[model samples]
Target: MTNAEQPETPLDAVRALRAEFGIDAGRVDQIGRLLTGGDFRTVEEVVSLTGTSRRTVEAVFRALEPDLESSGDGRRVQEGRAAEYRCLFGAREPFGVRDPWTDDARRDPAAVAAMAGLIGAAPPPVQALDHVPATAETVVKRARFMLDGFDLTGAHVLFVGDHDLTSLGLFVAGGAPGLRASVVDVDERLLEFVGAEAARRGWDVRCHFADLRLGLPAALRESCELVFTDPPYTPEGVQLFVARGLQGLRDHRNGRVLLAYGFGERQPALGLAVQKALNPLHLAYEAMLPGFNRYAGAQAVGGAAALYVLRPTRRTAGAARAAADDTRTAMYTHGAQSVEASGGLDAQAAARVLELGADAGEKTLLVGDGWPADAPGRRIALPAFLGAPLPRNLQDHGTALVNLYPGFGASAVRALLAANAHRVGLVCRNDLPLLKDAEGQREFAGLVAPKFRIVRRLRDTPGPGQALVLAERAEPEGDAERVLGYMYARAHGKLGNAWREGLIAARKAAGTTLTKSEGRRAIEASASRPDLLERSLMELPLYLFAVLEGDVRRSVDALPG
Candidate 1:
């Protein structure tokens, strides 16, 4: 049939389709334009032009089929390249329209009666003062998942922040049977809103108004097991919130603090600063909630937000004592040597001994009278004879015992070995009584027995003017030239001519033949190569010796062998 001769489609049918499907006004105009152009003669054409799936097009047509009239043969046919299903007459009457939110529309008696008939009377109030009502079902679902991991029964949970849309919604979604959930906010308006909502739902909720910046209320001290805090969006606000939140938990026995904050590339420095502040406090971050801004809205500004779970510091008095004891045990079992005052084995002497050990594939210990505050090695501090037990965390790292002494005792030596008995190469020299006593000897033997193969020697007296000793428990695997190159780089200018001379004397006494110039060249070459210096120092042999001798200071001075 000709286009003008075809039956007119009523406007009513089109309007009904638009209202029922919630199609945008602009999309409806586009459909009208297509119809005027005679482009929507078939269902397939409508689907193709609308960019909607076939099933959706069919559904739309089905909804409007009753309002449409058929014309021509009223047959479904296949065109040359396109498929067609015909809807004959156009729309006629327009559909009714009303505002979605007007009180009349929302509370219309007829509408309320119909709804009541369908679902029965409104759901019972779960609580007394429900402030915020929840709408987004997905949010509730995700929150339920987070709560699954926690045991909230009988727990005092505090939500701190402004009671906005999200807070209110969360209150409703998370309010469980027998769970006490309270909201704390500085703004009274938000609290009132929450209180009203709770009252509507018959929910029993407590509202507290306080300036979080000033610190938590004294009443909450040690009472909260979980504090959920979403701070203001600003960095300053975040910092203040974290500080105050942490302080609030000082008296908590097993309390946890949850913080929510926004972060972004533009303010990476702020995030790093927060991390620095939290690290010393030993707080660990558990999980992050991204895209929280949808609910936080403008409060979240533009960046992403994350949730951090923090707990109190984990370090204990016993751990500190154990660490100290370990240092002493390491020193005695490794046989740290004391540099004789007349030997002139200063820092330069210690550095050279480290180099010689590196070159000879042996480990050496240079026990000084005082700690090298900037020394590059493991540091062990020994205080009093048997101060607190050594820290519990100290572990044997194959070689090295850099002992620092405030004052020493036989217990220091025992603690050092007890902590690092597995390490190889024992270089111990102390003014304290040697492990000459039977009990001391047995303890030393027990520590060294399993790892004695790495120990180069038992005890060797140094020659006059010789401030250090190069003990070879095991020969390193490599060309002497390369080994010397590594040591030279590590020692840098720290190894002076005097130290090299002492090394030559020590090696000569050990029955190794080498010229003074060769020894000097080897030391100089190693010191010059930066790459070899660090690597050589870390090797099994050099690492053990350097760590032990370089770190020994006055801490072990009073320690009994």
Candidate 2:
């Protein structure tokens, strides 16, 4: 078997094809094998078999145009040339071959395209969060991997941060009958979008709002069988997201996590640091698929990401338990939240914030980091304050000094509503989006109206784009306000329980005697959506919150007067 005996063999042909077609040797090998398979094939069929893009297949056909016989919708090697071309292929399958997740990957290509369109139409990526949308192909491939690798039937998944919208991707590409998915994100726009879209699709996807730097909600912890995350590409970012993912697992022994990460090829040290961080996590690298993820942004990493399949080791439990209670916030690569960035709201402004909230006393808490030393009683890191089921200290604060600088209005709103502080002094840029205009202020004010009587304490306060917001707990004004306030006060509790008590108490205030059982009956018989009761107010979207309010108020009004 000398080289001369098998002159211009498959290896030589592969090289020749690579040179002549200007395609990579790997792609040349993939398309070469599929083209000479002794059957007519369309461009898509070849793509399906080879896992190459449509353009790559078309280029192959163009390079082989003179030798091939073409016909409608399919083409093949010319009559007697099949054997000649077939012998040019390598003995082994090429690198890109993968078991398709479903016939839909090829047979129903539009569904895949539709997924891309949906992501495009949704909100654009927010740079502050390190959001770079994954390519549609990557998203489809992810769903394929999910369905192909695990039994998603009746499986529970927690998407630790789903700005990628992988939750919808699963529904679009997979047919897992009982797949249960949940998404926890700090982005309200994304959460609201996902919530509405999932509802429209009649999906079992539930969205919970939480900034992972703090903690996961009690309801979401230990509730999923699979956790997937594409976190910011920093060591702290990787660990924090993965830690929250770990916390979401129902049972460590049976659960798994998928992590997407990328770094410039020259920056192997950065990648290594992230991988090293995983050692403390005690996770086995079940698999690593290089360049498995293609992104629309993040060009420094060549617009690609690696997909890591991870499984927990026996010793993963103790460290995972610690992560469940851990609160570390430096995760991003840019903005004030980035790994190297620090220093919270300006110190003098912080003092002003405390001064404005002075009546709150020493029991007051500070929510964010970098506050001047000796400025507070109890201090919660920005991320921890936003954690669901907030630290106990937050529940009993007197006057809390909150640093909401850099326009974290939505998060501040959610955090304050859940806190039982008598008054909260909000520190933020004067031009804060939620307070910049009357309309913005009015809308934001309405969202928190049930809890706080917010007043602009030091409007346009000088120095470092700062302003002070003084929020004092509001007393229930009317029978309706009482019902709303009672329910709002228990925002962290189960909605139905709060609604039931609030209804009975408010009706009693109106001089209407109603038994607890009667109030329950009133709700059961009214237009109230009972399912809303099962959700925590802290997790519910503002729109959904209004719906809950409407349901409760309507249920109360319908009560026998």
For each candidate, the alpha-carbon lDDT, in order, equals 0.38, 0.74
Task: Give lDDT tens digits, candidate 2, residues 1-561.
Answer: 476644254344444556754544666666766767767788766654554555556766876665677678888767676676666656565754244443436565876797878898888888878998986767777887887788889988899898878888888885498888899998888988988898888888888887776677767888999999999998888988898898889879878999998775446798899999888989999988876777766766656677899999888867876765665546788866777776456677666666666664347777776477987577776655554456654566677777776545547677666667787777766765577788977877888888898876466653455667788888877766787798777777777777789888887787877788887887787644565667777777666767666776678677786
How many clashing residue pairs appear in each of the predictions shown? 64, 2
Could you tell me how far off, in angstroms, the CA of residue 457 lies in candidate 1 after the best superposition? 90
State the TM-score for model 1. Answer: 0.31
RMSD per candidate (Å) reads: 28.6, 8.0
Report the number of the highest-lDDT candidate.
2
For model 1, residues 345-450, the per-residue Cα lDDT tens digits are 3455345444433333323222324424444444443332112223444332334433222122222222333233233222334333333355655444433222
| Model 2: lowest-lDDT 10 consecutive positions | 5-14
